[model samples]
Target: MRVRLKICGAVLAASVLVGSALHASSKPRENVTNASDRDYPAAKLSTLRGKIAYSPGVHAHSLWVMSFDGSHRRQITHAGAHADFDPDWSPDGKNIVFRTERGRYDSNNTGAQGIFVVNTKTLRERQIQPRTGGLFPAWAPNGKRIAFTGLNPTCCGEVIVTSKPDGSDKRIVKLPTAAGECLAWSPDSTKLAFCGHQGDGNWAVWVMNADGSNPHQLTHPRAIEPAGTGGDSPSAWSPDGKQIIYWSWQPAGGELFVVNSDGSDAHQLTHWDGGDEATNWL
Candidate 1:
């Protein structure tokens, strides 16, 4: 079947820390009542199954997992400390990998940030990469290795490294000149998709062999820089390995979009005027 490319124009930008207080009051009284409410519009494809996990609201950094159909919603963690933002599910969907701060307001403290794993069924928690600063954790397609962004205080963003499930065999894969973030491993596990800045000061989507060879740029010349409002960016690879879904901000708010793996046929998927970011896929 030919993959249909869909790009949602609603762009959900990353939430930034406004103050020192890591934990804020929960939803307002009026908004609190709406917490249990859910509305899952039918998606074109039913094959996508897993729930979308993300940190919601302005002050609520807690992690949440909800079904694509808008049923079976649950909050996995209540860690009232620094907001837990990035959550990645294991290939088997049995465990969730994420990054969290050690204290309530220590975003700059690299020592406080590390990778952790949670058993979805048992609700048990354990630190996987203890004492090491990392973010944007992505599981390998085989569910054995995990790729994450390692931070080097002396430098900016560190190299992308894959480690064993237990935090062993940590090795860095050489990327382009810029630092890497928001990593997505291809379905076949042969290539990796990430966003990084080029020497020219523009952020663009880049692909590289899993073994760290033949790194190449995927976006066009005009969209290469950070100034352009819209263009290709980092995103997750689809299950079929034919397309990538990412967020782009144009005249409208930032929204989810899909494009061919080779960087062709870009299109929008969501049309929310307020914007919606693509957090994960089933």
Candidate 2:
């Protein structure tokens, strides 16, 4: 259900064979610990950046973490059958939130896949709800609530929803996105930055009240596909809740961008020869 950006072994081999054909690049970033970055906003909680967690080679796999320079590569969770995807760190940096799916698909699912929590230190894992349908869990800055995408049977489409860490008091925050839409908790925990589709059929970054009110669209990019691939992306909230980092696609493929929380002063952050994804703040 979740959009998978990782390369498949088959695709990886082909990409390497044609690496020079689709070359891209990234622009210089001013600061790694600035207000626009997500990690800095959570510094008040002293959360550790910890390891760079991701899938090893494909979408249907376990979670992995690596050192800053890609050394010490290790798989942290051994989730089988249910593929582990969408790894997010708790505000305090002690635990991680992820979803387990039965098959490979975009990050969104129809409530069959469930959200889970794992303690980074002990590797202990548990589901917040024994049987729930959700994916792409965004841990709240205050460490009390979480936001994710789940099925809305009434609309027969996916809707944004939130619940306590214990999976109680669930509330729906309806928005326009099918799947692959990600949620980011504002540093203040009152608002959330997410991706939604625009009238033009392209995905754009958006912000909304965490309680499911006052939803607003922020970014407006011409989707290269000219149809819509999930609209522009709203990846993660800046540590200060002032801006967001998201990914966009062009003829050259996907690149990363950062925009003000109010949808102003957007700037390109990367021009990678391949592509970039919004993961941890860094």
What number of clashing residue pairs does each candidate have, in the order they appear? 16, 19
**Residue 162's C-alpha lDDT in candidate 2?**
82
lDDT (Cα, tens digit) per residue for candidate 1, span 1-282 = 000012221112211110111121121112211231121111111123445565553455566666644467688777684556567777677777877764332356533357788776788878776554776677887887888877654566457888887788887888784566667889888888987665444456778887789887766535432443344456567677887777555435555566788888877665545454433443
lDDT of 2 by residue, 88-145 (tens): 7777777777777643433443344677887767888877644546766888989898
- The 10 consecutive residues of candidate 2 with the worst lDDT sum are 37-46
Return the top candidate by lDDT.
2
How much does candidate 2 score in TM-score?
A: 0.74
lDDT of every model, 2 decimals: 0.58, 0.59
- The estimated TM-scores of all candidates read 0.71, 0.74
Q: Model 1: what TM-score?
A: 0.71
